[model samples]
Target: MSEATHSFEESFDWVVVGSGAGSFASALVMRAAGHSVLILEKTAFAGGTTAKSGGVMWIPANPFMLAEGEDDTLEKAETYLDALQELDGGAAPGTSRIKRRAYLENGPRAVDFLVAQGVALRRGPDFWPDYYDELPGGCKTSRTVVAEPFDTRQLGEMRKRLRKGFAEFNVLLGDAARMGHMRTNPDAKKMLLRVALRTVRDKLLGRSFTTAGAALQGRMFKAALEKGVEIRFDSAVTELVRGRDETGAERVTGVRVEGARGSGTVGARLGVLVNAGGFGKDQAMRDRYMPGTRAEWSLVPEGDTGDLHREMERIGAQLAQMDQMVGFQTTIAPGTENDYVLPGAQSLTGKPHAILVDQSGQRYMNEGGSYELYCETMLRRNESVPAIPSWAIFDRQFVEKYKVADKFIDKKIPKGWLEAGYLHKADTIEGLAASIGVEPAALGASVARWNGFVHAGHDADFARGERRYDGCHFVGDPYADDPARGTIEKGPFYAVPVVPGDVSTYGGAVTDEWARVLRPDGSVIAGLYATGTSTASVMGNVYAGAGSSIGPSLTFGFIAARHGAGLGNLA
Candidate 1:
């Protein structure tokens, strides 16, 4: 073993960078193993995107499956995942295979471990159907698990340092309205009513209750705290330090962290795990990596500026999928510096009556496609337009039947959006198009065709009526067979200019199945690890379901910790 006599002022068995699921899971595992672990979180809060996310962990064949008598076999999983590999064209095949194997083989094991560690896992309320439902190895199952509601009070002093996404709590209803999928689904209506009642009841009972994304993150946050993981808030990792032994074997020695207390070095006796997120908000990196995107549309936290990627790259870590990122079809608030509007809750599942179009005023893709696809299309559209902002055109009737995001809609459409010209309102389709700088005649023809489809109950242009996803439910009774269908025939149409927005960048430093960073020569860099959005995503570009991002994050984090701790006789 490396001599403990090195007079290390501060050292941990493992130093986990980032506060997302990957970081927390690794720290929890190492701490549980009786190893001292210290987590350096750049932000004040420990959850990172996990806290700001819809805390579902997508694990196929989890314990919930067994309880519900669902059939999920390793063979079936392998078959499904193999199909994904075929789709990916074998990019980073080794990493992709290992990830699929880990997820399929150890998925149940990870869930069991979390449960043993006091994380209460429950079947989520709904199953977001597989994106490729028709593909082999894909089927509807209770594979999604969420942590029970977490009580932030349990964190004690730590709660003050935690950060939550400003837009997370607000409900999303505009997306559903745009798709016209469901305004009167009894189940959806009941769920909304239940949420309202619960809010009132919790207030009456002097208890706390949060539904949706907030509830999910809260549960995981509480569970991580209970496991005795040390989370340092407001501490940013400025640099990754490396050193070589007499044999010239590369190893991570420590990390330089900066905080209000002043900057200092924290040595890692075992390994350094980097889960510090992606460069979603870094203008320089975005301009370099994604030349096509407009930097203002990034919806990620301001702190996610590729610190981990830059630091790791300085030490010669290889990167993968640099051309990819988490993509979204989004609307931007007029005259605001950073206000990007995402598809409201209802729109995510395809309830709204909106379709995304390119610069020439032509529809580009399935409005119900994955957010990643939406982003990719936006980037592609930037090839032709000076700016790649699309229009999310809707009618007043659509607004009446469903809600938009709590942030966007009001008793009257926000005047700032209208006056500043980010949003355009018109009594007719032609007028609306003219206000938004589109060809009035062309837009009029498009609206007329869309209305004809709505009345005939079928979409001939792009088959918009074919969408069926769980997130599509909305409020009111639009009375349409295809729940996401509504006509623009109603006068007073509205249009909100949209751009490509993203949760985070999907591509970054590449790692193996063990979460060890790899050099350009295809060799592992001992003592170096990465997880979360800082690493190339295991899911590739397709979003299979909710919690897809965090599931692999937590899993690989555990793998990295275990691998690092088991590096016997490092000296």
Candidate 2:
């Protein structure tokens, strides 16, 4: 709802800061157990970065999996995490095994609880593979679950209050939507019919269903309101107010927020939850910690400026795992004044007839690999090679068959993009390489090797299409012998410059299994909990499943709420 920021009394039973998934989940869980909850959002709008995201959670062995006869176990999940920690050093600089275990144990349980309390979530595509499907604990058919479509019209006037989705991903199916494909591709008749049916159903009901990010955030907003939690927007918390408890223990009592008119304090009887978003636009922080990550490339919500970090740092919350973050390579084009359009990681890079090359015109990593994995490769390559601003070389044939998440178009390029040099066009690979400032011979050799690999139906260098995950998202080519591997022989080559991009920030103040912020000495800062991007993520750098970040975010939020409400161990 469009809640007005008003003066509040000195006390509430519990104060939740930020309105993202973790914050809302904690607030609603506390309210469900009969606590007067106050949610403070810095921005006028709700949803944060999550509303623009694909609202899915990586539930290791969620109830949905069991009900659908998919076998997943907590033990298997641990094995999978162990593989990540061993293979890729998924563990952060100062990681906690306890919290990681907590995430696995309670992630599904938290989703189950929220579902029972009326969040319309269902198992996502059963064929969806984990980003690392070959790992020990990885399931071939992923256990990720997404929020079902929600009609924002149900919120009435609040529909206007939501933060606008990213122009790059603001469409109906937002994340990786292939609407334009099914509409024209004769082979996609069944999918096209399904889309048409859904559109009709939505119209018949006199409601426009919001998918992906909107669906998830809308449900959380509705659930919070249904349980009578008071949400105050435009109330930016500036400091954590510390005071002595009745027992003379110095603890976090409340927060100091700059209100619309003036600054005031909102007290919390139990504890304060800081589930606020990351510091994506915080140029200072980016310069200090993640120097390589450009502020312009970050896709976080406008309101995220690391308020929780600033306030919690004063209280001595140990902030580790800062090195780990979320990102993918993207090529952006201008949209409205501040908004921009771009392609997603899997949308174009994973498609056939594409080979990403560094400045030396060498394929650094598998082009069809997960964005996270490939970018990690690029980051390591940046130290010795010019991996920053890599290029994706493609022919007109690929563009004809598919667009990048429907952001990049087909047949012809926009005049603005071409003029701005965002989309480089050349008739030959040598011309394309020279246009983009790369060695012509190296580019030619890379494409030649790529064609050889495709002819063999196996990538000997990086194993691009060997796994199910690679083939899973492929837009099949009718003429190609191997759909995942196609020769980039068609003329009119194109190149889009890509940077080592991170989409979201991970790692914040360290927290325990109970979601309570911790000290350098591993003691709890009593009455203070943080989740989502506000605290160091439980999974460290690993994107365990599709919903890794959100799953731990919500589960930790549940753990905090239950513990604070005097109910023991919701996990």
TM per model?
0.87, 0.92
What are the per-residue Cα lDDT tens digits for candidate 1 across 333-388? 54445443344322632444555555455665556655676667667767876336
What TM value does model 2 have?
0.92
For candidate 2, the per-residue lDDT at 246 reads: 62
- lDDT score for residue 425 of model 2: 82
Where does candidate 2 clash, by residue pair?
A: 58-547, 327-502, 327-503, 508-536
Q: How many angstroms is residue 262 displaced in model 2 relative to the true structure, after the best TM-score fit?
A: 2.7
**Root-mean-square deviation of Cα positions for candidate 2 versus the true structure, in angstroms:** 4.0
Clashes of each: 30, 4
RMSD of each: 4.3, 4.0
CA shift of 229, model 1, Å: 2.4
| Predicted candidate 2 versus true structure: per-residue lDDT over 224-323, tens digit per residue | 8888988888889988877777667778888888867378888888899998888877889877777677777777777888878877887899987676
TM-score of 1: 0.87
List the global CA lDDT of all models. 0.66, 0.76
Q: Model 1: residues >4 Å from true position, as ranges?
A: 3-7, 85-95, 165-197, 200-206, 210-217, 244-248, 334-349, 385-387, 405-411, 452-461, 474-480, 567-571
